[model samples]
Target chain A: MKRRDFLKNTAVFVAGASVSVSALDFITPKELFAANPQLKWGFLVDTHKCVGCGFCVKACKTENDIPYEANVTRTWVERYVIKKDGDVVMDCPKGARDGYTTKLLDQNHSGMLLVPEDEIAQAFFVPKLCNHCTTPACVQVCPVGATYQTADGVVLVDRSWCIGCGYCIMGCPYGVRFFHPVEHVADKCTFCYHRISKGGDTACAQACPFDARQIGNLKDPNDPVAQTVLSQRVGVLRDEYGTKPNVYYIGLNKEVR
Target chain B: MKNHVWRPLFVVIAIAIGILLFRAFYVPSDFGSQEQGYTFGYHRLSNEQEWKDYPEKYKGNDYCNECHDDKIEELESAHHGTIPCENCHGAAFDHPDDPEKLTIDRSRELCIRCHAKLTMPSSDRNDIPGIDPAKHNQGEECSECHNPHNPSLEDM
Candidate 1:
């Protein structure tokens, strides 16, 4: 190329670089430049500590203002009673609203009585809620970007933007997402986003009378959730799905899916 | 150049430049501030206010701690320190202002939610024991034996 052409090209290149750099400044906001909190919220559920009183379930409904209904739930406790033959009888009658109580079954043709509590090999209450996964399947499957993970690692639903397609409900391996009966949008536990963002615990965790459900910030080294998760044996639900769930269980049983 | 190619190509490039220039002016100056790196239109959703202002049902622990400082201090130092007061008492939406509205859930079922044990895989839960409510204190409220705030009964 001629020297004149080369000079022209160099000037154009320099101008383009300067404009692009300045354009980036406009695109990126000042708040983004501020120091990130680097907080990742997590939950720990101790099954052994859970008594299946269903208070957490009730608390979640109340805290989230979930309308009174049998089908929709942000959280629920499953009572799993494993028989001696390894048959697991899981029940959460009315989401355990009345709590678990022994009910004598009518005698069968063989005149067998209800299986004695002592005879049952094992039983435990596994309280289930949104895992708030690191790589959430619901977020991944969202059709209109309605479901998204915040910078702090809490998965949330943009209800206004959600189409109520129910893709997230089906995509979630933990089955946390549900279509709100009245709102007609896909909804699930947000780890109490409104509360947690203001430095409060999740509704269920805060309402856990026995401290069975605990919410902590993984970013803070002093946070119990961070310390416990690092020091203790924590298990995430459905690890095979590779969702990297933030909700960990302290005494997760093999019987638990 | 082909007879038809030059005219269409020139028009397409002009339109493309026009759109880009228009977009450059249209996008807000603070559009991508909260978001890092380049996204086509990610920041528009970040600017929304609805996500931040959902109707909060639980009034939060701080609200309770404001008026009940003594109870907060006692619970903070007790074995049940981790348990929030609202767990035993229902969410006090208008408490302190309307203290009478706060419902203290002293139901036996409330106590059993965590105190009653079910079997699970063996792991360390710090020996947080559970009792069959029926067997432990039949027909008796949990508060009869153990103080809800100070379960260790040190204060008593």
Candidate 2:
């Protein structure tokens, strides 16, 4: 083997190796995960703003078409009346109308809901929805790979793909996901993807009387949620658990204290 | 020699194309989920708080009042005046545009998702807070109980 021949072969090999490395570096696998709209829809729930109105719960049902008998809530407003004595409670048993409620008038006070009679022991309403977690335990636990995270951070379940195994139901830390009795698939808030995709708001967000529900693209910086997180002292539920949940609670109940 | 060499390569290439074609059209559907959200290691947060967004187009509920003169009046006068139509009834594109292919939540489940009792099997039954699911009927639709035209409870 001549010296020139050996060196030429070595040079070619080095060039090929460098080319492969460059290609690998240039094509980030993250691009494949890129959301076309590049959005992750989520919510910033202001507990302070919520007046314990069951509007969100009602709106979610009216929007999702949940049957009254299912006894399921895609979104629920938990009335927390912290009596001066320090007992946290809800307004009513959350009475019903026909099937779903569009009207969440503040017929709710603190009796069946929460009977509060103190300055410091006053109660507030907190609306809850799917955390739309980044590493959602619900998505992780699905035995049939039914639940999925969208490219833009939205956690979605393909109604067609869901196996109704209830694995997701068990895994959700927030207890928001449920199994559809008829469809037999795990279901939760799609963030109203069908509505939002076509340009609209989630029923819960719209139904909220106090603007307690604010939905936006967490990816977009100009959104009100971004401003809220940037300006206000906000907190998330179970942040220590590390779910990277998208739901933000503004003025979270001091009871967490 | 060239023929022998290219023949196998051509066959392999042909087979690959066939597979591609089969997948493109014949595939019934895709099952399972997709990548979404900020997973722990992927988009790790350095603090107790993070940026959050609402899950809808922030067109501002004010837009609901733009063309809906009569609706705005009724809604404002009704108990739900403060609430946006898009919120309670789901995005009402069909009603506004087509009315037939109504994109509304035409089923009873839409209402049930809210008004029905909340059930959490994983969380402590006593500790967890939500409406009790035992009181409502699972078979009826929202319109069956509440009248859409009048938006009332009178068995319309």
Candidate 3:
């Protein structure tokens, strides 16, 4: 090759290489969740705030496209009925779809038929969902490595990688995970990963008619989640299990499981 | 002996060069930021599309605030500032273009979800003062006495 041709070719190659290299500046560590470490998603369920509306249950089903069946529930609300004898009876019929005020048996009755008032000493509703633990037992037990925690502290299941093993379902101390009916894979709440990551609240949180459930990013100092965590005394479910669940409950009772 | 030596060494050198060339062109530049860098066969899992499965159905609070500035202002100053508007209104998936489609839920059961007294200890929770909805205001909607926007009952 001629000297002039060789020099011209080398110049073009260098310029092209430099341009391509500089383009990588946009894909910095901050862009890919490495340097940007100020976001940890969490949930707060104020038991005092819950009215057993069951809106959270319906919303989660709709958002996740799960079948609206009694057996298949991504989240459920348990109505704990403590008897006068100090016995606690918890039941959630179809995830409380009709709320707690529906007539128990309204056969040809004009007015509302209430639950027998004498049967209960004290009663309250507790909405349950995935805790998204700091040290998730489900992820640890996932034999196929399908269940993993994201950088932002979200526990997610790679459906494509999951082998339908129910190990995660069994390992979760909070009883959050389950084998998805149709998908046949271990499934649980993701803290509404897609929505929360984009600054939107969880389906359950947004569907809560009474603001009983709220999603918060603990890393953001100005977020309401920070204020709720710092100002209030929040408790987790089964703290003795030591899963370090991110879900916080504001008014947990001693008898609650 | 000389021929035997050159053949195997040349094959090894060629294989090394092939791997280097493949990595140079195929591996993502940003993979350097990841802890594993690029684990040859498993690098295919790094596709952005892998984790982008969930659809963005809920249209966040700011989207609602764009048009409902007055309502947003009222809520921000109220005790329920942190509560997003969609929580009560249902998901406003397409309300911007079709405002009439937006359904505002004013059901009494909606209010009762947070207001009804539970078995929680008094010291643990500060908000949502417990009220037996059946007896507190028998057969009356919560909004009859307290405005949802300001909820302190002083606005009534």
- lDDT string, candidate 1, A93-195, tens digits: 6666555544332233444235565667776778899988876777777666666766666677766567889898999998888888778888889888777
Estimate, for each residue in B25-130, the C-alpha lDDT of model 2 and write its tens digit.
7434432222333222221121101112222322335665676667777666554456556544445543445444334555654444444432222112223223
TM-score of each: 0.69, 0.59, 0.62
- Given candidate 1, what's the lDDT at residue A78? 78
Which of the two candidates, 1 or 3, achieves a greater TM-score against the reference? 1
Give candidate 1's chain B TM-score.
Answer: 0.61
lDDT of 3 by residue, B1-156 (tens): 569889999999999999999979865553332221111111224432455557655676778878888889988888877666776776665666655577777877777655665443321222557677668867887777788888876666
Instruction: Score chain B of each candidate by TM-score.
Output: 0.61, 0.39, 0.61
lDDT of 1 by residue, B18-121 (tens): 99999899765544423322321234355345555666667756778888888899888777787767767777866657557777888778766555554443
Interface RMSD of 2: 11.7
Docking outcome class, model 2? incorrect
How well does candidate 1 reproduce the true complex, by DockQ? 0.21
Each candidate's fnat, listed in order, reads 0.28, 0.17, 0.12
Compute the lDDT of residue B152 as modeled in candidate 3: 72
Model 3 C-alpha RMSD vs. true structure (Å) is 13.8
Error of 2 at A102 (Å): 18
